[model samples]
Target: MKKHLLLLSAAAAALLAEEATLAPVSVVATGVEESVVEQPEAIAIKEKPEIELDQVVFQKDLFNSLPGVRIEQTGSVFGHMTAIRMPINTGPYYLFMQDGIPVQSSGFFNHNGLAYTTFGTAESVEVLKGAGTALYGSDAVAAVIDVHSTPAPSEKRTFLFKGTGGMYGYGSGLLEASGPAGEEGGYFANVHYLHSDGWRDHTQADRLEANGRYDLAIGDANALKIILNASKTEAQQADSFNDYANITDRSKAASDDPNYFKALEYVDVKRKFDYARLSLEWSNFSFENLDIVTTPYLRYNRNRYIATWQPNLPANDNELTTLGLLQRNTYQADWGRVIFGFDTEYTRSSLTYDQKFDIQTSGWSAAYYQAGTIYDYDVDYFAIAPYAHLEWNMSDKVVFSAGLRYDYNKFDYTNNLEDDSYYYALTSKGQKAIYYRPGDRTDSFNHVSPKASLSFMPDATTNLYIRYANGFRIPQASRLYSMKAGYETVTLDPETSDTYEIGLKKFFARHTFVDLAAYYMNIDDTITRYKNDNGDYYYANGGSSIHEGVEVGAGYAFNPSWRFKIAYAYGYHRYDNDPKYGDNEMAQAPNHTGNIRLFWTPWQFPGFELMAEYIYVGSWWFDDDHEAGKYKGYQLGNLKASYRYDDHLKLFAKIDNVTDNEYAVMARYAYGKTDYTPGDPALAYLGVEYRW
Candidate 1:
């Protein structure tokens, strides 16, 4: 690692000298007003024209410009999946932000909740590469993506409408309005709805979301901003089946008996989320050079899931709800800035499973229903966390950041039934009822996480940085609720990882750019699920593991009419103990992934644009069996065209998965099953927008 860092530093130095001493023309464009240069490497020297805010707002165009970022659809309108080819999930890789505020759920593996933001309503999406947990939180182990909404103009009220429809009963509509509400106030509101029938059988999803914000100038130096957001999503379950031959044929009937496939399962899921925030800003406080800002906010979220596989029994329901309050204050000084914040989150979750078995299934043919059967079990959980982040500019050429967080969580479980199910109590032949006593269990724990980063600029053509962070994930309620008879309660240890990273950013001429990063992480007590001899599944600590990777992205403009962009990521993971499973890498994580895109604007039509892009994902493991083989690699292509009519009206069309290729973003097999499955089907859409 030391040698690699040294080599990178030497290469950056050589590039800086050649570009600065030999090149006579100015290649770099410094447009970010607040961006401070710390070291010689911090300069962004480029030959291509500067990328303004407007150019980075659109998806097709933006993806074409970023180096290693790959944006693909997960085959559903209400949900999309992004993979960084790293350890982190896509939802956390990109920070979801409304305006400038962060929007995220406060639980592990729930990063998918960021989908609450309606993509149709976004004005711009920003993708920052590399780990960002130092600035965000534990979940940002890969990158930070920020989505910004349009801001209200000062002149007059503006109204915008957009709608899209296409094959497979796919459609979406959005309405937005913004303008000056009064002499010192402005407001913006957006509402959107999306639906898709989905390509696979029994796979459908829909979502409705809305957001509104108001800004008020309280006085000459003070301003207040308020925001409200709400969203609801529901979908039919689409678990994979293991009839390998039938599925491989692609002609199997949708109504085929699912019992033939041991892994076949289905579920119905719904989620609701809402949040509000208020902020106050005082500029020129005490002195014209000083500024102060304070913000306080509240958030709420609820999620519920039900499985329909066991139709004879009541549905299994899992619900989680949370309420939180947060306050932050920032003071700007001449040399640097100080930011202090405090937040409290209270979350509660309920898990219930109702069990029932038919007399025939239980081998009690003489009885109408199995006697002494356990009816229901419930589990409740609570958690709270507090955090703080600080940034300091030690000098004109260097900056530093540090953060700390503490979390506390508690869980409890109870059985509502007085008797054990005959199925569980009876011998292998089911000749008698099993008798057991109802009971309860509880557990709690506390954890602290810390992060640090340093940014340095050696010259106007380069930017260099290094970061370190500690992340932790608490065990889920499902892990505890499925315990077997011998254990009173499942004892879970927190999973933790320590990450280290270094990166360099550079620009050649104004139109060409490159960003590269390398990272390594050590994970302890990694949580993994396993099945016992009786077929009951539970979570267990997987000892230790190591993950390391490199990511690189570059963009270049061939000429005024055309440009090219490419990005690639390579990663490797391995367990450190137990020689057998040690060779098995993490699931769903490919060692190689990348994307390439081309953007064109014909000289004859300046208002019209065209784009084509391709994304590739390498083979990956589905489970811990190193000999189970691997899921084959796959590629996807996309095409987009757009025309602008003045500044207020624009039309666009996009065709995704142009080859109509069948692939899976993630694949899993359980209950002693095997088979690689396809993900979502091909999709296409066309839309128009009218903006004032």
Candidate 2:
């Protein structure tokens, strides 16, 4: 891998060797008469700096400006922080796009939790708060994070590279290139590799990824673009929980406990993911006072998971595979935009359980017994969804947007078992088993989700907006149909939620910006998982939840060399309908969080910059009982410095967890109590980049 990376880097440098040169020009005044008439001229024209919406931090910066956005450090690739959550068992599924084309796996559930792929190649990360079913597809209940790659520069050729390394055995490298391939075409490619030996026990991982894209300008207003992305990751599981007494007592007994560290139990996992997309876009710029665009796209993704466990019954081993395909079309005109799309998926899973038992002979000899069992199955799912979005400007200051979507899904299951009679008997007793028969059992659902938003711009410096949206998520195959006895599926209703938000934004002095938003969410059919009497886990929709929050963010620039930014958010979430769990706070969600950052450039140092940042995540509950009190809040600090050696070369360094504070962002139920797992303490890195 190292050799291949070096070769690609050399090739990129050679391609960008050609430099552009411009010639000076002089202007001459022609024989034209100019008339000057001076009067009172009392109207004072306010001198204002040009404001581009695209350059605003809310639109471009995901970590600094976006509300409800958190960047946590998981012991995954690079040892650097990932834009993920606190739950170690739940994976953060981020959306990847090349000019608005979705390039992510459709199996949102049951995917490996340690796969973090995109890095070094993204130009911007858009963190859209709340469920994203209206824009994307299913499994977007939390939020939608989109990573967009930079487009090909207008220059003939460009090359970029970066590298970093730090404590706890952390390292990363990246390479990217883009240039004109021929008269009317261009090509781009990016490759990155990262490895880390985590700050915590039994947390070590590595990852490698590559992305390639090509664009051809067919005509003045038409283009064809294609992209291929592949990523592979292998890591030791970090889901182990520390003993609750150990965290609370902070004594030697706690540290000596076997369950306090992951290394005590031998576990390993691996994952591979790949995605590809092809799109054709056309635009019409010839017509006056009107703009039109149309795009048709096809996308495919594959995900694989492998795991191995030691000292466990049957030496636990499992594998799961999922494949997906989708095609979509979108059109935008002067009045509004319309979108239509369809998707399908196939998945296969295999699990094995093994155990060993010891037997004693009567007053003679001792004997040992060993047994192993394997379960293998495959499931294929076919789904078709047609969706549309429309937006219209009602007046000069008030704009309206609305969208509707409908989905149809079908699932087929096949199993290989030595005892078919036992499988048949088990299915006859479960509600979800009706969907699985001797052959294929198919089921479908129809969903109509609506969204509306209104915006009023009273003046250039002040704006107000209100939005209401309905979102839903369909159950995955693993949740709806299981082959194991304790894994009976539930009769899950569609989970739906209605969100209402009001936002205000103000701009002053062209260098100061502020935004505030408040929202309320009501969930109808909330799906929650719990353990049954037989120690088996199942999902059910029997309650409702209410969530309300407020967010505030501001940025101020003292001058061109110094700037400061701050953001704060407070959220209250509780169960509304369940008499048993009504007033309980939701788990894994923080109640209060805030961040501050300062960026400065010294007047004497021409090409050097420095940044200091602080982030705080408030106390949170891990379960409904509130008896756990809180997981305790934490504060983290980070520092970054960069120096531009030249136009093509730059060097930078980042130091995370500057104070080496030990804290927990998540917890798990273990030994009749919630056990907290601490976050990464401290790490640092240095890197260099060359861009031309």
Candidate 3:
């Protein structure tokens, strides 16, 4: 098995050397544009293709084909997660950006945040693995996903439209155009619409988005780019199932609730998001040897969600508005290049919940009461971060890099309903109302992260690196403010991680590329959620944990007509110290995962292209204790076919889970019950496009 894997990696590394070098310029690693091969760290680039990216209308599967990455999707609908280098799903472990701007406010937790972002207008994507906090600040512990918008085409004018319809009433339409705005300016714009009657009961989706960008050049040293985007999404949530053994009906809801959401089969999410950004960049505009870049941005989001709790559930209205700035300067020197960055953000958020029914006590016994206002709060969050990095090109065979970042964060919270009081039941002393008035408070934290790396090149095609990086995540607002019953606001410490890694990148024969990475991480003060015997929830630090993993990926071109790629990852993630769950495997930490893909273009068939892929995920644990039965491992196969037909027209079709396999993409335990969300069954889509 080991020998076979070696041969596969060698061949896989050989497939896409030229394409990897296509864009040549990227800005993800150090916030500066440079050739990809010049970076000392591990980074992968994914370009949009002429055909559909996946069987579904959404681009959730965009990175699943890559190695060391896993995106656990839910029931072929919305709910999704990004796991790279980290084992956990929902937390401050990952960061998502568009044109280097954050898609959402940091420390905010939303499972399906990707559903609202625009991807149709993107030119390419870059994924960076391991610790990025040395430059990214908070929430860059595991990985970072950056989406770069397409640059305006050189043509005088260009227009394109794409449409698709397929199984389950799936439909999609997109219109895009790019060209010169005038003599010295360029613009790109697009609008997209997608809807689907999901595969299961009470699950459907509708979303619309519009995005535009303008680029202007001012003389020899200054450039400006403006971006605007808006999106509206109405989607139903298909929650996971609790009974893992009895899934007789796959299309039904896992739990039966008598609330308005369940009775009328209403939606779980109704949201509107708008964003605007202006970037001013200067090359040789600072001192004789320095370049400076600055970006100022704004974001707004208004959303309402139906509470999924049992009994008389109410709705929550939330509004978040933010203003931010990112400024960076790089100095060119004979010895090495040095970069300095300063970032700041101001956010105002308000949340109001109405008529939430809770178990309260009128006297000595337990009672159920409908509370008028469970929570009404507003907060102002602020962050000021600064970082510096140095890239030293010692010689043709050796490169050294180091960086350090400091983040200062503060939150000022105020309760709008300070006078509003409520009584709670299930208290340890019988019946006691939790402190309904949290009053006003100010909290702050400071964290510093540092990193260093050394790279050696045996030849131009092979690069090896050893590095150490540190990252940390500040506590989420919800964890700090959402006090229930007897639990009060508990002062929390940030979660910190120290990682040591060694990796290799090789591009041989100019047609093959391969990469392998292994890492060990030690994390302290990992926060976990729990419920006491009285049913109130609290967050506490789970002493320590250990995560270690190995990843391999390769690509090779068999000939002018064929190409192949493969990726695999294996990891052991477990708790190092915790009272009851000591040494238990963490939930949702899949240990073994892999993907294999083959692409073919027949010599006789002029415009025909075909692709086949197989995916596998090995089970880790369902709960902290690890479930009892069933094989946690499963495999799936997907296929894609396309015909270019002509320069102005094309057609494509894709099928996922070709064998109709049954598996679980996400599983966990909640309220003492094990729950799992089954993977998507076989699904297909067909589409056509026209460009001029």
**Largest lDDT belongs to which candidate?**
3
Q: What's the true lDDT of residue 561 in model 3? A: 89
TM-score for each candidate, following the candidate numbering: 0.77, 0.76, 0.90
Better of 1 and 2 by lDDT: 1
Give the residue spans of candidate 3 off by over 4 A: 1-25, 50-56, 245-249, 252-287, 309-314, 355-371, 419-437, 509-511, 627-631
- What overall lDDT goes with each candidate model? 0.53, 0.51, 0.70
Q: Report each candidate's C-alpha RMSD, comma-separated, in the order given.
A: 8.9, 11.2, 6.6
lDDT for model 3: 0.70
lDDT value, candidate 2, whole model: 0.51
* lDDT for position 265 in model 2: 37
Q: After superposing candidate 1, which stretches have Cα over 4 Å from the reference?
A: 1-111, 126-154, 243-294, 307-316, 333-335, 354-395, 408-442, 480-487, 508-511, 578-580, 675-677
Q: Comparing candidate 1 with candidate 3, which one achieves the higher lDDT?
A: 3
Of 1 and 3, which scores higher on TM-score?
3
lDDT of 2 at 643: 82
**Clash numbers, per candidate:** 33, 3, 15
